[model samples]
Target: MKMICMAVMLFITLLSAGAQKNIPASDIKTAMMKATRFMVEKVSNRGGYLWNYSPDFSRCWGELEAKPSMIWIEAGTPAMGNVFLNAYQLTGESYYLKAAQAAADALIWGQHPSGGWPYMLDFSGEISLKQWYSKVQKGYIHCAQEHAHYYGNCTYDDAATYDSGMFLLRMYLLTLDPKYKYPVERCLDFVLESQYPIGGWPQRYPLRYEYVKGDKEDYTSFITINDGVHTNNINFLLACYTLLGETRALEPLQRAMTCVLALQGGKPQAGWAMQHKLDLNYSPGHARDFEPAGYAATATAEMCRNLMRFYRWTGDTKYLARIPDAFEFLESIRYSDAQMKQLGKSVKPGQILCPTFVEVGTNRPLYLHNDPDHYWVDYDYHGLITHYSSTRAIDLQSLKDEYQHLLSLSKEEATKDSPFIGQTDISGTLLSHLMRGKVQQADTQKVDSLLTILKKKDYLPGRLPSVSKENPGFSDAPLPSEVISIKEYMNGMSTFIQYLTK
Candidate 1:
């Protein structure tokens, strides 16, 4: 009788704990609204939303980076516009509609000649003819990058076909413009034609272009083929095809998905590497020429995320079947306690090809940097939180528990006499806690306090801080008194908002 009573009591306690885990919808909405407004205010300007805007309306960057501009326009602009769209949907506010239209106009103006966008743009109307060629040459680094740049440039070459197609698809969806449909169809046809016999798209088409103009034609041919199915390219292509509801897309997507599956690293493997004319070997952890292989984890995770979406749209069991493998791959790369202690909380993980990092001291995987590149890994707090929210295999309860652990760990680190003061990781960890949906009112207050400190210190500026190797400062970069360009920050914030809204 005593044992039975004890067991029953324990069960009830667990049930109560589980019940308490859910965050109130009202509270979530409030926090989300506040954060959204803060982000929007940081990006918006008289012309439109600049990519990045500091809290004081000074210090923005990448208003000129054309590629980022298109990404912002495609990913972020829609997000901000959607906020108003959502408002209109719920409350029938004309103000939201006006804001959405303005955002759309700004994005449309950012488009390049080829119906594509450049990676960067000079917001100043001072792009010379020489600069134009320079931008064009740089844009041809890879098919996807070129496409991104091309879409911004408003060009209609074969290079811009895939990304341009996606943009067109989005435009068609947004404006119900029949004009977009023709381009989208044409681009899809081009993409299908470009696929290799092995069922993969190349990193870039006509790959013979040397890195330098004077260099010997690297492949001794006018057209060089980077015929490998990269994760991003494959995902984007799959997404476009899936969106188009094209029967042709199904096979290619499946093949690409399967190929990605075959690339998974473990004791037991799936497929072997194939011989190709172009250097197709890009793997994780091997430090070679500029084409490093170690940036696979995040890529794989992103691909899986896209595949999940593809499955969602197509209801294809095969796409669904691959989810577990991809999930397992993500799990395997998760930075363990051993890995965390090895990598440290301050120093970013060495060339992370993985999605989630094991929070220091707690050993729970939380999404952090997507790339191993120092400049690129500048504390992607929003991406991490978004990935955590989107992951289906990982239960919400586990996420909340891990988030709490990360929060406690961050608080502990902040109080310590550590070297990494005003680092973005601190903010990222705090953001993770907020996203966990389990923060107590007191904890939320603490987060707000820390955020205030970070904001006042100008630590949240979107640009990479120039750290001195000889004498690193408390903060990486000085706060700008005048506003920088707005492209990068607006684009980044908009990307974050779009992900959340979706």
Candidate 2:
């Protein structure tokens, strides 16, 4: 009986050791390099990357217009820059520095004339041409008629004013160039001026007093009605505060943070809700609900990190205490073992849900909706995975096991040869898995081969491929590739890799 027990224990120990040996650090590095390289080559342009490089430039262009965006240049540029930054940090390579600088330059140039940035940029010159066509035969008929005058001279505006400023501030912290400093200051000024009397920043600014003939009247003011004072604004403010600490901007940062906390929804229990106004002292209205939208998790996590940095600089726990609840809120929304299991069952093998849940509330099941009909509806999980990997909030063993399960599921799905289980799901999940330290040499090699194929095919240089309507389950309408929004993912991945290296 004693010998039997001893034998079982020995076998268990061997299995554990075998599992440990199977995880190759090299594989993780290789896969990360592949994905990062793909992101850099494809998403990057001038100094910033286009929001997405899929299906074609037209598709990428369309996705940028489909939403009220602000963070594309700020997020995507810096994200690409950070990838280079990480490479430089790891290898001390001048090439990486050059790449980083290019991205920084794009970001700097992408800043709006108003000292803020748009959520998108018409880098391709298409939007400007469209605008020009609409104005032809109107007030500027001769001006519009002169193709020689506007051919290469047509300039585009930044997509979102606020996001541009915020991204510039972040870039300033990294580069510390005097050139960046002025823009940051200007952006700060613009944000202050644009702040609503009620507290939140308006969705767009100067109210576009009058529209150009043939131009669509800016309806951002009306759209702002539904947006509320959001967590995203709070995050940008916090980022500005962190980057420009103890400056004139400090007081406004404090005010914004205080206002955000005041807007915390109580019935949903403790997490923040979008406030209708900026008053820190006012009671939140019934219109607000605690949904995970508005980049809540990312904002909350960033706020926590920024607050901790603030505490370090200022020696205050007040900022530090705000983190636990925010962290708890983020954790509540992440996929648990049970949740992942259910998601796996629903997704045909290779696919995994990008954003694990639609909202912060519990009592929801994992399911795919046909309307949006991309493989996954949400891309927010990239942020969550990044936060988890960086903080080590969850058990490493648990995370590794879950990643292995995901890898198995991906492999299973790939074998079925379903077109739906394509690069989006495979790349996203595998990259997330590698970030969490579950390294598989075979999987990594496969990803590397796939990336090589993509590059050789010239598919890597343009926007992400859109799903074809011909596919049985595919949606006819365009599905935005989360990869197009490269900034957040780039930063998150860079941070995760840096954390792991440390």
Candidate 3:
């Protein structure tokens, strides 16, 4: 038995050595360069990208069907730009830097006159965009009821502005280019000027309060926390202050933190809603019928995590103070077996699973079902919307454990690792933060897998996400079964970059 085990061990070692010998680092580098060039030159729209695109480049999408001229600011465009910068950082490649610069230029051009980005931009011009808003966006009946009208304003929703700002910040720090510098300052000014008196920011600035939800006014002007509105804005400001020595961002950063504390619901219901009114009350079911006026389970969990982050940043116990109450609130709202069965979820005790939205005062779980014509909300978890997560899993114990861990740390220890503190050399600081835990250990197997895929095709093909309708109101062109995805390319390139950096 001992002899057999030794033989197996020797065989495994030889296999590992042979695998390493077969795929050289230069081969991986060459493959990454080829794949990246294909994405940048062929798939990209003026050095920008959407979520995915048809191989023939005839069709594309961000949140919806897009004009070839349109680029998404949400996750697609900024994230791609970041990947390009990551490549440049890793390889010292001027082509990657040029690609990143073109993306920055596109973002700069798309920047609203108000100094932020829209969720989507039409490079074809405003007339074409307005037409899309009236026809395609308005007609596409999905969860995006918010896009039914074009406010012609900049948004903080879904990290749109902050992501764009952060990309520009990185560009400026890397090159010290005055062009990137001006936009970064403009974005900071926009964030500062748009902040509410109570320290929260509206979903959109230069607020247009026209879109009505039944009887309530549009929640776009409300203090939004949905999709990390405050967290994203505050983090961007913090980065700006820390990395750029922008003193103007300091006060707003403090105010934003305080506002997050203020936004917590009172007693028994010490949780959070997606958005809050200008008066700092829980926003009504204004955004969507499915997203009713309630303490959102996912939002509360994220807020708890954010509070922990804030505590780490400032070494303040105040941020940790309400976390226990929030966790307790989450614990109280744990779903029953019947509710779980109705929602098609298996019951697991000691595992905190519950409905996405809890009633504001009563703490009862709320489930929703919607069709093209109407939306219904009830205690019944059956027939919930396929578009949204009607049920959310909360990590009460993990949160509690994390809280204790934070509490264990001394003040200096807690604040020392914060990006806002003791960080010098913008490029080094940004790269470390950006590439933190990214390929800390080499995964040659992953590099091998990625190289294999690249060898088969120049681009990765992935199914289009968030496509609800067959003929999604935008164009007569048929949606492809799958497309060359910006996300896939980013992920693949990121793996390559991480492998190389390691």
Worst 10 residues of 2 by lDDT: 383-392
Model 1 over residues 1-502: C-alpha lDDT tens digits? 9999999999999998776544343443444344445444444542244344444543333322232222244233534454444444444445545565555455455554333333333344334423543554443222122322222222222223333344445555556767656655655665565556555554334322343223222221211112222443454455554455567766766666555444443322111121123334422221112212233333444445544444433344454454555445445545455654544332232322233322222323333333322212222334432222211222323323433443354443433421123333333333222112111233333334433433444223345222101111212356543343333323332332333344
How do all models score by TM-score?
0.45, 0.47, 0.91
What is the C-alpha local distance difference test score of each model?
Answer: 0.39, 0.42, 0.80
lDDT of 3: 0.80
Better of 2 and 3 by TM-score: 3
Model 2 per-residue lDDT tens digits across residues 267-368: 333444222323353332211111212323333443444444344333334655545565555555556557566434233333222232224344132222
Reference-based TM-score, model 3: 0.91
Ranking by lDDT: 3, 2, 1
- Shift of residue 392 alpha carbon in model 3, Å: 1.0
Q: What's the TM for model 2?
A: 0.47
Query: What's model 1's overall lDDT?
Result: 0.39
After superposition, candidate 2 runs with Cα above 4 Å error: 1-43, 54-75, 124-167, 208-229, 261-502
TM-score ranking of the models: 3, 2, 1
Candidate 2: Cα lDDT at 39: 57
RMSD of each: 15.6, 15.5, 3.0
Tell me which of candidates 1 and 2 scores higher on lDDT.
2
Candidate 3 C-alpha lDDT tens digits along 33-110: 888899888877897888877888877778777778888898877888888888888889899999999999999988
